[model samples]
Target chain A: MFSKILVANRGEIAVRIMRACRELGVATVAVYSEADRGALHVQVADEAVFIGPAPALESYLNMERLVEAAHHTGAEAIHPGYGFLAENPEFVRLCEEAGLVFIGPDSKAMALVGDKIRARQVVEEVGVPIIPGMKKSFPNLEDYRQAAQEIGYPVMIKASAGGGGKGMRIVYQEEDLLPALEAGQREAKAAFGDEAVYLEKYLEEPRHVEFQVLADHEGNIVHLFERECSIQRRHQKIVEETPSLALDDDLRFRMGEAAKKVMQAVGYTNAGTVEFLLDKDKNFYFLEVNARLQVEHPVTELTTGIDLVHQQIRIAAGQRLSFSQEEINQRGHALECRIYAEDPAKNFLPSSGRIIYLREPVGPGIRHDGGVYAGFEVPIYYDPILAKLITWGETRDQACARMKKALEDYVILGIKTTIPFLREVVQHPAFLEGKISTHFIPRYFSEWRPRPPSPEGQRLALIGAALREMKQGRERKRPTQLMSAGQDFLSPWQTLGPWRLGRRS
Target chain B: MNFEFMVDQKRIPVAIEKTSQGWEIDLGEAKVVVDAHWISENCVSLILEGKSYTLHVVPVDNGYLCYVQGELWSLGRPTQDLEYSQADQAGAVGDKLKVKAPMPGKVIKINVQEGEAVRENQTLAVVEAMKMENEIKAAQAGRVKKILVSVGELVDADRPLIELEEE
Candidate 1:
């Protein structure tokens, strides 16, 4: 086992990986940008180093800076959490050249699967089902339109280098293809710095299901069942659950095997997710592959009682698979809701501000992987996800019930969040019946607005307001001038000078 | 004490009195008792009508930004004449108003000058933040009265950009 590892990411995933490393009796080194010097991940890690400025290009995304940080801290290995440099094959190769163990698949498998078009070909060669579409990138909008016509109407134009739904568009008519293609290419170039795009037949109302696959360097591979992630907005998943209501045991077994086949075909190691789109008839097609630990891995952990990060480290250390396929079973149902710092009504645009207050939900079956705390400034330099709220129960209904309650218990102020929107989604009757598809949000919540507070809620607000007045009035009468509300706006690092770091108990 | 507050921009009259168990509040249509305990300077644990709730209250310039049941409400003492906030008055962006940067970023470009005519949804300026360039659009058919910002200048969130007079 490695004595120390450097986490090449920030936010909740970085903290999450550090926690796993601590549990395994390993030291963790965290790299942070100037904006993140006092971030939760920095505070949580065993050691910390300054990487660069706030912009990711000069900081988290800078492979050289990360390698230098690892070398300086004497970290034997580097773990790239989900975002930032996680899936960048160049970063992996750089780490390897530096003689550091990259806790993910080797660059060879990454290059082969990281590109959406190449993965489709690889999966197709292995007899795994894939979406019927172009295997090559379309050079122009006219070529894209012709491909869409051949594939029939209602086709999806997607960026070849895209993930997270940034460079994806669905067009129902040939006339709209040109604009949609242009938009997709533009977004792809801006978000991923790649303008290449491909066309595919758009399946109406398909459920997005993916399988979690883990492999060791010795070629041993296993699939951790499936997670249904049909609840999304703007092509990004917000809600996910395990043991999809749409899949039966037979289908689950088949998909699990197929997921493993794709991994084996690429000689892949470490942890990855093989995504598929399931249609109404139970037929599934390969979507793409996520080449790192996913944001929703906690759902799988809750259902199977396995810590995926631990397994990833073990595999990266060249260890054999400790458990076989027969050992993994879905003992219960789990659900996860991503808490984002955005307003659902205004097209989910990212919102940035200090978190004036934060109360994470806690109890039996509730797990919150949060990145920020009260007084933490959610910067505009990165992803808007603040935390992921997950709940597990013996049955699906129990899990849903707990999820609704947990959402209610969760409180965050000073910025708009998607909690209310997610709560409505889980409580919707269609969601309870497991009849959701990728188009669920647009189909059901096209005109969704944050419902106004009820009369009871108004009464509560009034009481809260009155209490605020009383408190302020009392504070005004006191001789001390401490505890100003403005204090919440200042970063602790700014107020406390540099932070003093020591090993946390 | 009796007070009037603007809830979601609508004025509501509320009456409050301290009771042994909690506080009694009377809205026009009904009355309810709320038990509230201050958890912090801005957070309160409340039980209203026998249901538990927690509220986060932040003080704004003329109001308290209260969060209740996943909704944010700006609560403030009603103005003597019930003057509308800039948003309420600027709704539909008619004769005169200033276009503000919704969120802070660098001003990449300004498409209109101080006396240019513009149509609704026309790109007035572009601000880049979080690596995405957002085009600030005109809300109504108007002529630009003043350009408050210049290209390449960094602006804070919600800072006014261009003033417009409806054409």
Candidate 2:
């Protein structure tokens, strides 16, 4: 194993990776941008390096700075946790050129999967089922119509350089194809300056399910299981769980095998996720590849009892597979809820501020991977994820119930969060019954509002507020864990409250 | 001590008196017995009539934000004791739409220029915070007078981005 590894990310994921390194007895280095100088990941690492300014382009995404930081810190390798430059092929190649092992797939494999069109062609050649679509964009309108008929109706015309849903249209029948194609091309020309458009079958009500795969240097590959992440807002997943309700044993095995096959074909190494869109008819189509440790990996870890970070490190250190595919088994069930610093009530707008108070939930069958502490000023320059609350149980219902109770126990004051909204999701009858799809959020919760507090609830809250109002003077700063661990006496922190917004009058 | 608060437009008047057992609280018509203790700076543990509940409350600006279960309730306002609110004061700045930011962030882009006519709901500027771009939109169709803040300028919550004269 490498003696020291540099974590090339921040937030909960960077902290999570360093924790795994500590367990393996490997010293870890953390790189931070200006906004994250006092971040949890920076404070916890064995060594820290300042990269650049708050803007990601000036820091985290700066490939040259990342490589230099690894070298200056004497880190043997760099672990791009997730986001930023994790899937950037140029960064992967830079690490390789600088002789610092990148704890993920090599640049060749990354480049192959990074290009959507090429990856689709490559995976299809390896017999992995792909979404039926045109391999390349066409300028002619008649060609799109012919391809749509072959691929069948309900086809989507998307710009080759599409983003932000621009230059995209879905047609259910032949009549809508020509006009839609012309509009898509015109929009594409005005938006991306690329009039070329591609055609593909659009699957309605498809669930976003993905498989976690691990590969060693010797080409040995195995899949842990599947995570159904259908609960998403604005194309970003918020809730994820393993052992998808939509998949039977036979279907699970097939999807798992297909995931491994895709990885094996590319000669990919380390931990990566192969995403699939499982449709209503039980058929699955390839979505894309996430070439790093996923945010929802804890669900896979809980079910399979495998440490993915440790495996990634070992694989980068040129180790062979320690176990076979048969040894891996999906245990009961595990669920993960991403606790982001965003308001769900106001169209899920991002909310940022100092964490005036924070209390993490704790108990058996519950694990919280948090990235911030009380008083940590959540910077306005990064991802809003503050933590992930994962729960395990012998059954899905048990996990669901545990998640609900744990969410109530979780307390993060000041900034708004998705806690109230998530609690409603886990308890929604349709979600509990496993009837969900990618449209789950829009279908069930577009007009959702936070339930009104009960009369008693309001009374207690107002009374609590009144007590603070009566407390003569106010303490301005945050309340801290001033008491040392295992202290017998009650410190002032336990008996006195400090942080208050101030009296209204 | 007597305190007044508002929740969703309803007025709540609470009176409290400290006692040896705990504190007795009077909610207008009814009186409730309670034992309350501060567990942390913003967390209070209260046992009301033999039932236990931990209420998380944080003092923010001129108001108190309280959390019960997953739901949040914000009490009071900047004009807590005043009968009229900022909403009523809006007429004072009438005929000019001051496009204010909803939160503190750096303005990454200005979508409109001075004297440009913009439709209602059209994006006026984009403020990037917490790695998300929040589009500041025009509430009514209007012509921009002048941009108040430059691109790349960091702004506080409610800082007006631009003033729009009615079009």
Candidate that scores best on TM-score:
1
Q: lDDT tens string, model 1, A1-505?
A: 9999999988889888988998888889989998897688888787899999987778988889889999999999999997677777778899889999999999888877777888899999999999999888866667777788788988887877647776787889877788677667766765565788898888988999999999998878999999999998878899999989999999999999999999888868999999999998999999888889999999999998889999999999989988999999998899999999887777666778887767778899999888887778888777788999999999999999999999987878777789988999999999988889999999999899888668756766766777787678778899996665645433342354223358355
Choose the strongest candidate by DockQ. 1
Question: How close is every model to the real structure, measured as TM-score?
Answer: 0.89, 0.86
Per-residue lDDT tens digits for candidate 1, residues B1-167, read 77788876678888777888777778787777878887766777877767777788887668787878766677877883256565556664542367888886778778888899999888899876655556789877888999999997878876889998866
Compared with the true structure, all predictions reach lDDT values of 0.84, 0.82
The DockQ of each candidate is 0.46, 0.43
* Native interface contact recovery, all models: 0.47, 0.56
- What DockQ would you assign to candidate 1? 0.46
Candidate 2 chain A TM-score vs. reference chain A? 0.85
Model 2 residue pairs with clashes: A498-B41, A500-B59, A501-B59, A501-B60
**How many angstroms is residue A431 displaced in model 2 relative to the true structure, after the best TM-score fit?**
0.1
Clashes of each: 0, 4
